[model samples]
Target: MKFPQYFSLLIVSSLLFACSNESDSDTEKSGIPAVITPVPLDTYFPPITRTDEWETVSIETLGWNENQVDNLYTYLEDNDTDAFIILKDGRIVIEKYFGDFTKDDNHAWNSAGKNLTSMLTGIAQQEEFLSITDATSQYLGEGWSSLTIDQELSITIKNQLTMTTGLDYNVEDAFCTDPECLIYLNDIGTTWYYHNAPYTLLDDVIANATNTDFNSYFSEKIKEPIGMQGLFIKVGYNNVFFSTARSMARFGLLNLNQGTWDDTPILLDTAYFNSMTNSSQDLNLSYGYLYWLNGKSSYRVPGSEVEFTGSLIPNAPADLYAGLGKNDQKLYMVPSLDLVIVRMGSASSEIQLGPSGFDNELWGLINEIIQ
Candidate 1:
């Protein structure tokens, strides 16, 4: 019965036009025209130094509209944003801190932490520690849920990653991971609900599969090698990650490069990486292993049953994908544009789990400045 949140917001619709301009005489003589290809910018291949500091690019050098950029910042401030950053070709283009927040201040990624867990799960699979196709009970032991052993064994790690565990989310606390809380709703792989308990249990899956603590495994596999700084802390039944804005950017950069950092391969499973970022199931074409995708024909939001038509963020590039969390902690990347953006702060007045109206509005502002 849930309704769409931004049903009335303006949807920007503009097709990217690729054309060639040539002299009429030449076109008539050859029956063809030369198409000019844009020279690739050096920013496209910026050095990936595994250091704390990142190289930066000036707005003037990028030729972005200054007045519009100011307007974008003003809009962000008005919306209670704490930290905002934009990376072009892995180099910082715009970085800003508002109120008392500083570059070094840590912020919780909330549900966005699921993206990290997804990556680690893939890494575990690559190392032959476990296969995602294996049943969840394989690692967590049987009877972890109140369901029968066969019913419990029906759910697989990939189902948890894709939110297709068919676990009942109608309990008193959706976030509760207790056996009593995880009741079965539909059969596995038949339903897609943004249930939290099944997703939260992935930490245990990774821990048992690797025979190491979740945080330690993450540190050894991803953080230390990529120069990322963060730690996952337990909050109630949820394991939320806290990290600086730049650290979040580093993760986005790693994903943007298809699981490689500075030519170092962190996730060697190309097939898994492709499947993780692309559509993982038919129920949610706009969702991939914990990541949200744009440019899809339709999308469904968390806590809502209605599937809205068109792209998730109309103003964003068609190739845009994101790790969006509560209160709009966002890690957005557009592969075609070679862009990465991060935003961390309090929730907007209107709240949803992943993509929201704020996304379209922010992208509108970005399009203006970058045009």
Candidate 2:
């Protein structure tokens, strides 16, 4: 769960680009036609204070044998599952739950929310909130300007999304107070480190450009259109969402379709989807726009012949990208298989602390059913 915290006003500024095909326009290659009228900034929803209304799905005919489904449920029940859902070829293949979780339960996306954060950056570019090429200096201004000129020159929205900010990779700096201590140390796009602070800084960029809180902007722009009843929780100084497994699956489904939700084009451009799922950083070739990719480039458990090394679950598809959270929350998308798998739970033991052998195990079972 991300808490919305205070941000330094020291940043850069840029004028909103018209979503045009001009040389300066960021929307040209994206092919999502430019908007005639920019979306109003005032439409943003306030921090969630009302009761969350859930979208209901009646599940009676997914066709899995009750025993088989029960076996999966039993497995999760024994392991602390809050919810799990599987979508095959855009259809709900299975949905199961245990341990105080329900269809309406709102669980924090934790780091799982990072992908959504990245996706929103693309969406913001599509809507002309800010261009992808706009330097970080444009939004983060004089406060950031105090840094060495070369450091200021290297910062961009792309670096933030790709986790290539050239910042230090120290876990102790997870929630650093002084942004200056974290200076740009390498080429902007050349390095990759799993830094949450830079990623979280995006909320300020989006909010500053759009003139609203990140939660409301995301709710209006992303969740509502897809019929996802999710909320970006803002407690004290952090902002994150609490969503049900089904809704998380839907978010993955949106990615599986390359940023389209149903017939509506929420992302405005699918090109952003391509670059997002594919590698965006050189160091960690296993990560995309705030989303983690499984298979070849990733580190796997020792002596696991499952050979999941870089293989996205064939049952789940090799192109699968996931939003992984602390304590075992996952929203996985497989493009070729047209599948989305969501799991939300607390870890029963320290087992989830490493490359979960469970992912390989779960795929082993799901493959049998798919075959």
TM-score, cand. 2: 0.74
Compose the digit string of candidate 1's lDDT tens values, residues 1-371. Answer: 74465542322111112122334555778877556443337544333344545677777677778778888889999999999999988878899999999998999999887889999999999999999999999999977898888889999999999999988888899999999988888999987888889999999999999999999999999988788888999999999999999889889989999998876899999999999999999998899999999999988889976778998899999898899999998999889988899999988768777778999999999999788
Model 2, span 1-371: residue lDDT tens: 64344322222112222223354454566678754533222111112232344222223343334445555667777778888887765555577777667978889877788888888989888888898678876877646533576687678888888777776655354545245546655667765656666777788889888888888899888888776777777644356778877678778777876776656688867778777887665556666777777654543221131223455333345666788776667787776655678888886456442235466656665665544
Q: List lDDT for all candidates, in order.
A: 0.87, 0.67
List residue ranges in candidate 1 displaced over 4 A: 1-52
TM-score quality measure for candidate 1: 0.87
* lDDT score, candidate 2, position 354: 25
Candidate 1's C-alpha lDDT? Answer: 0.87
Regions of model 2 farther than 4 Å from truth: 1-67, 235-238, 297-316, 351-355
